[model samples]
Every structure is written in structure tokens, then in C-alpha cells.
Target: MNGCRWMLAVVLAALPVVAVAGCSSAPPPPPPESRAGRPDRGAMLIAQYGCGSCHTVPGIDRADGLVGPPLTRFGARSYIAGELPNNADNLQRWITDPQAVEPGTAMPKLGVSAIDAQDIAAYLYTLD
Candidate 1:
């Protein structure tokens, strides 16, 4: 009985150490936003461009406009403006030139620069 009790106590005492050893010791990877683009900057640009006036964008203040489709879950969407495939490149292109992608799209050419478009696309992808 004494031997069994001693063994059980030893095992219990080592349990915490064993559990900790099994966990990863290295730092975690960067977030998807960082790898994809500057989502933070994108959000700011979206507001600056008055995108909220047309689309109901999450995370942006007063972004509850009903003119265009809501931008919720934009990251999970399969298409952009129901035309181009929803990818970072395609999104940037669409943002920069909506008329070029869809000739009659209600979304006008906002004159978004390439770098700004990249950041906006990055921010939209974070909606997922």
C-alpha cells in the first residue's frame, strides 16, 4: 500500500511537467492579415473613401449604408461584384477600376491608387 501510494504521488507531481513539455515552445505564426496585407490601413482607407456610404461594412463606424450589398463575410465570398473571382489581385483590380471589370457596375471608379487598393483588399479579406 505504501509503495503504491508513493508511486501515485510521484506520477501526479510529474504530470504538470510532462504536459508542459508536450506543448509548443516556439512563438506562434503571424496573423493572416499581416501575411496578406495591411488590414488596419485598409480599414482606414475604406472609411476615407466613403465606402460605408454604399456598403454596410463591419468594423467601420457608421458603415451601415444600404445602397450596395453588405460587405459582411467578404473574405468568404467567391466572387467580386458578381464578376471577377474574389482574390487579392482581382479585388485590387476591381477596387481600382470597377468599370473595367464590369462595364455597367453601379460601383464607380473611385480613383483608388494601386497601393491603397491593396490595403483595402487586405482589410476586406479580414471580414471573414
Candidate 2:
């Protein structure tokens, strides 16, 4: 009984620290604005741009192609196309002009405007 009580005391003392650690490890909540691209618009743009024709994007209809890499966990990726950093700006650049970012890459320049690219990137980032 004494040993059990000691264990309980130790657990109680460490509870707050454990909770803090858990919160710290969690990803920060997204900003409450349209800055990161409209997730809804991004989804629409993904379909409009035929992105599913090559990449298997989650949550998009008929996005089950196998030519390009699956976009699952795209938000978690550290880099884009193994070249540019995986960021909103870089993603926009890649989407609007893939050849300029990586010459000879299979991802063709889709003529995505800057805003549309942001929307697409925003949608991709939500796939965590």
C-alpha cells in the first residue's frame, strides 16, 4: 500500500509536465484567415487542374492515378519534388511553373495563376 501510494504521488506530480510536453509536440493550429489558401478553393482547383491525372490526391474525386507520387501526407513532407523546400511559396511556384523550378521534371507547367496555386498549396497542406 505504501509503495502504491508513492507511485500515485509521482504520477500526479508528473502529470502537468506530461501534458505540457504533449501540447508542445502538437502542430500549431492553422491561422484563422485565408492566407494559407482556401482549402475549399484548393480542392476545386485540384480537380480543375487535372492534378489527379498523375498524383493520387486524397479527398478529391477520381484522384487515383498512379503516375505521379501519391500526395498523401503532403503537409508532412519536408521538400517538394526532392528539390525545392516544401513551403507555400515554393509550392505555388512549382504549381504555376514546374519546369522553371526543376527543368525536365514530369510535372508540367499547369498555367496555375498565383492565387490558384496558393489555393492548391493550401489544400495540399491540409492533407496531414
Candidate 3:
């Protein structure tokens, strides 16, 4: 009986040490920094606004639609909206104000903000 009591006491004494040793929690991950002129963020913003709802964009599935041509080779394409250059600036301008770039088109003014348009251009740049 004494031996059993001593063993139980030893285990009880070690319990607090074990619990304390396992008490620490790991640190959280760092936050991502925003870049105003960045494209991936733009693409993300455009996506968030549901641009993929009517257009075909790679790297983002479930946003596919047959209404517009897929912009798979956007970087390689020479013309956007069939008139303006397919560069970053042009893409932003076109996204920000598509009707202004194209006199008459089915593309409606979704009120996409300027920063979002720019970030979208950055995402399009990744197609290259």
C-alpha cells in the first residue's frame, strides 16, 4: 500500500511539470502587404467583383461564362476591346471605363473602382 501511494504521489508531482511544458502556443503568421499598382491584387479585386461571371479567365475556375472570349492569352494578345492596346495601362483604362474606350458594347458599367481595375491589370500581367 505504501509503494502504491508513493508511485501515485510521484505521478501527481510530474503532472504539473508536463502540463506547464505543453502550455506554450505558437505565434501567428504575418499579414500580407498591399501594393497599389500590383496586378495580382487587381485580379483578386476584379474577381471579387465577379468579373469572371461573364468572362473566361484562367487560374480561376467556376467564374467561366460563354458571354465573352476567354482571356487566356491576355498578355500575348495585342488588342483589347478590339481597339486599344492590351498593355497594363490600357487594360486598367478599359476596365475602369469600358464604355469610354469602346463606344458601344454589351459590357455594362459595373462601377469597378480605379484601384481594383489597376490590381486587375496586375493579375492579367501574370498571363505572360
Candidate 4:
């Protein structure tokens, strides 16, 4: 009975330390605003230019497009137009200068400015 009481005392003494250690490892709450990264702008420009008229986006549905490839899964894509890096900056450049990158993409120069293209990219990255 004495040995059992000693073991119980040791366990009782350790309880508070174990509880404190558990709390120390706990993660803090996330921030209210999700500003982990900058939003894409090129994708926003695509919508503004009405590129959806040809390509199929998750939210957009229209006919008379057929002028370019679909962009529903562009974020997960490995390459832009199957060559350049599939990222916001590259996408913005592609949207602003398709002919410059592919040289024969048949995607006309829509006169999209750099800032507008970035806004479009910001919108597009949200798709994922």
C-alpha cells in the first residue's frame, strides 16, 4: 500500500508539467485576413477582356469562343501554353503579350496594360 501511494504521488506531481508542455506545443490561431501571398492580376485582366467568350472558366459560360485554350485549371497547369512557367507573373506576361511569347498563338494583342494584366492574374489565382 505504501509503494502504491508513492507511485500515485509521483504521477500527481508530473500532471501539471505534462499539461504545460502540451499547451506549449499548441499552435496559435490563424490571422483574420488571408494575406499570405499577393493576389494574381493577369487572370482578372482575362475576365475584363472577355476572354471567356472563347475559353471556358469555372464561373463563366458563353459560346463563340473557340479562339484559345480553356483556362479552368490554369493554376494547376505545369506550363503556360505548354512552355513558360505556370505562375501569376508568367500568366500576366502571356495575357499581355501572347504573340511575343508563342509568336503564333493566334491570340490577338488586346492592348492589355501591365497593371490591368496583374489584376487579372490576381483574380485568376483565386480560382484555385
Model 1 clash pairs are none
What stretches of model 4 exceed 4 Å from their correct place?
A: 1-45, 61-64
Estimate the TM-score of every prediction. 0.72, 0.72, 0.66, 0.59
Worst 10 residues of 4 by lDDT: 29-38
- Best by TM-score, which number? 2
Sort all candidates by TM-score, best to worst.
2, 1, 3, 4
In model 3, which range of ten residues has the least summed lDDT? 27-36
Residue 85 displacement (Å), model 2: 1.3
Point out the higher-scoring one by TM-score: 3 or 4: 3
C-alpha RMSD values across all candidates: 10.5, 7.4, 17.0, 11.3
Over the stretch 1-128, how does candidate 3's per-residue lDDT look in tens digits?
99999999999999999888777555533322223478657667767878788888888757697787787867777788788756666777888888898877767778987777877777776775
* TM-score for candidate 2: 0.72
In model 1, the runs with Cα more than 4 Å from the true position are 1-36
lDDT of 3: 0.74
lDDT of 1 by residue, 1-128 (tens): 99999999999999999889778675643232324668899999999999999999999998888989999998888788888667888888899999999898889998999999989989898888
lDDT of 2 by residue, 12-108 (tens): 9999999999889977644322356798999999999999999999999999989889999898887889997677877888899999988999988
Q: List model 4 lDDT by residue over 64-88, tens digit each.
A: 3766777665555667788786676
| Model 2 spans with C-alpha error above 4 angstroms | 1-34
- Computed on alpha carbons, the lDDT of every model, listed in order, comes to 0.86, 0.87, 0.74, 0.68
